[model samples]
Target: MLYQDALLERLESGLRKSLPQWGLPQDAKVSLLEISENATYLAEDGNGEKTIFRVHRPDYHTEEEIRSELAWVAALREDGVVETPRTIPTEDGSPLSSFSDGEATRYIAAFSFMSGKEPDAEDDLVKWYGELGEINARLHTHAREWQKPEGFTRKTWNFDTIIGDGALWGEWSAAPGLTEEGHAILEKTAALLRKQTDAFGAGEDRFGLIHCDMRPANLLVDGDRLGVIDFDDCGFSWYAYDFAAAVSFLEHEPYLPDLMAAWVEGYRKQAPLSDEIAAALPMFVMLRRMQLTAWIASHGETETAKSMGVPYTEGSVALGETYLAENG
Candidate 1:
């Protein structure tokens, strides 16, 4: 469902009308920021206060799931575990507000803006990954120990949910510029990952809820402190997968080994990860690539999809082939 210009304009207009419900003044300005799984807007009030307004794509996330995500984020803030965008409630005291133009129903939520810069891929990635490692550790530690509210639920990033025929992000075969050879190699790579994962097994220490999307895009470099935003994809999965996600689109970077090592070193400072689990890091990387391949295939209109285009899929294939040659 690519949002045509007219559709986006309509949504922005609707958002402006709904602003007052969230305490924004009538003169608040709403502008599109980014579009991925959702259409995000940067809403600024007359006094220059800013907030992020996310209009979720229809049929992707249930109301219950959205509530559950907010609950975990709220808990993280209250516990001082990490700095997440504070979710704002509507006038009715509800976390989510709904809007529909009689065609598609959109769920909207607002959050106080967290300001920071994103780490550049050309920069010292090892240093950035080290900071990310510490951030990932803190989130995982909180996920393991924190008690969930009643009926709390979220998506799962297991093999079945990610690479299976009914994968949430669509099939990798459809990713643009994916060759037959590429698809074949990726299929083999997927099989290998499944086998390794079964062998590694998921013990309580190794699996739990995680911030599944840890790419640089989700990170905000706020001074010396790093702030993580976007819990839309938070779910249960292997703890080591977080490392794979940290290096998500940069798998082909030559300094990948150093980055992974830095992440491991940073993580070990907070909690213990056995060598056996560590050995499966490549499998997680391969898994994350597969998931991204599917995401790109399904989300053709997104800026991420447009920028990466065919080159990203081609790179994934090359990476998959190399991984298989080394480990198969």
Candidate 2:
């Protein structure tokens, strides 16, 4: 834990240095909020006003890609397609700033503090998931109709980028505690996914820009508003992939069927759902499971990854076996 502690201290220092760029008090009380793919902090000024500052992990996204993400967030808010946190510009009116943490230069962006807490399992999950489905449908519709700015670019989450040789998170084959039996099962599952997704094809309606990480942790519930946050992973992918992402890390839960049904019902209210795409939802979920397995292996330093550990790999194997039996 020494390494993580040291890293946090460095990042905290960087955040303090960055606050001035956004015209915030240098002595603002800043606390770490989360440390996933990025280090997020909550900064409170002397007047009690708050802002969220996100320090990007090095090498994950270029400056251009970060700007593209903010651009989309701006459009989504401006067009009333979704309720997202507004970006706070720097003193010079730039949406992003940078700080050197000695090892590498990290980009930092500030956002208006959004009010709400993440929805928990004890809540009315069915209702919340239904709302999530509708929200995703609206995002998909916007992705389809909106005109992207020139030079807009983001990563693509196809089979190759998700799990194959080009896997972004890392290869699932390297997952902790993955036995030979489990590896074989995942191999078959991957083959089946390739065949099915290839046959399904990437038509515009089926595939487009997506919020690739819409799990509940990124959702905030305040009264009737369901605010979505964390666009760090947004990119090009199958539209149905959003549902798969929504159920991340809970693929084995019993209520999943009910949740999936609610999501489909809610999504249908906003857009058409082809039988082919609907049938492929399970495939996408399995694919997401595998992708997350890879993520756990590569990001073991984070608490979330460490907590999941070998159990998550074993669960992926079990899920893969069931997927192969049902779909292979």
Candidate 3:
């Protein structure tokens, strides 16, 4: 059974062998920075050079699924449209490596670290999310050319599971200050989405490889360039959902038509959106909000998460309150 330290040592060994091949120095002493549920480490050479090493979770996928993930990124790189972490093979040139905690661990892969700065909402809000929108555009563009990987299947994004079925609202109604109105909103919103989700199946609206999670945290900005990471959630899905995600998460400035215009402008430079996409953006915003709202509502005071109540449900209610008071 490989322990965490032993697994890391194995990862370091892989990096020591691979980075130099990418033209990194032999004197590189890689400094490991962050490790997510999917393990990644940052290694720095003597010249302060850094690259990311990835350890894929075999529990989450098959070797084919792993191949599909990198292939999607590689396809985009080939098109000269985006920056994907260069996959560094093992000593034998295999794109992925398998190891065990003996407790059933997963497949892991290593990559050359990408460079960039993390954007923040507290500082320059609009610009920060706008940058995220640009990266989303780039990711989905060349991604359209990539072949679907062998072991991969469609991902639900769980939108319907999270908010529909009345069972969903039933599951979260006991939390403090949760009202009948919020529950009703969840039921109604989910119903509306379900009836329309497949309304544009795999057409221009549904086609393309989507970076399912386009949250601001996954992006890196260097000067005017941006890099995106965390593609474990990548899959074939609605192209507009990508826009919906970028628009919602990065809507730092007031949610207005002008800011939406800026995002559309930047996204078009990579892959343009259609009129269908434009019309659905507002509903997508509503859907993402409610999904997060319901998730938080179910797990109030989760030690690691920020809030416990539904976000959009309460938010819209408060906005309504404000509107009514001013008018009445």
- Per TM-score, the best of the predicted structures is 2
Q: Candidate 1, residues 1-328: lDDT per residue as tens digits?
A: 5778887888888788788899987568778999899889998877888999999888788888889999999999999978789999998899999888668778898899999977876566688788778778888999989999998989987888888866888998888998888889989998888888888888898999998887889888866767889999889999999888877788888888898898888888777878987788888988888889889888888888888889999999998889899986
Considering every candidate listed, which one attains the maximal lDDT?
2
- Model 2: which ten-residue window has the lowest total lDDT? 1-10
* Model 2 lDDT per residue over 155-225, tens place: 99999999988998889998999999899999999989888888888888899999999898999999988
- TM for every model, in the order presented, reads 0.96, 0.97, 0.70
Error of 2 at 74 (Å): 0.6
Q: Candidate 3, after superposition: displacement of residue 310 in Å?
A: 6.7
Give stretches of model 1 more than 4 Å off.
none
Model 2 per-residue lDDT at 9:
91
Q: What value of lDDT does candidate 1 attain over all alpha carbons? A: 0.86
What TM value does model 2 have?
A: 0.97
Clashing pairs in 3: 30-44, 51-113, 52-113, 56-108, 58-106, 58-107, 293-311
What lDDT does each candidate get? 0.86, 0.90, 0.58
- Which digits, one per residue and each the tens of the lDDT, describe model 3 over residues 1-328? 1226776676556556555554566457666665433556676766776666666643556677677777766666667666657776656667766655457645656677777766664445466556656766766755665565666554445444435554232243443455887556545555566655656455644466788666655667777766777677676666666755654433323654555666666677666777777666655655555554544454343321233334444664453344334323
lDDT of 2 at 15: 84
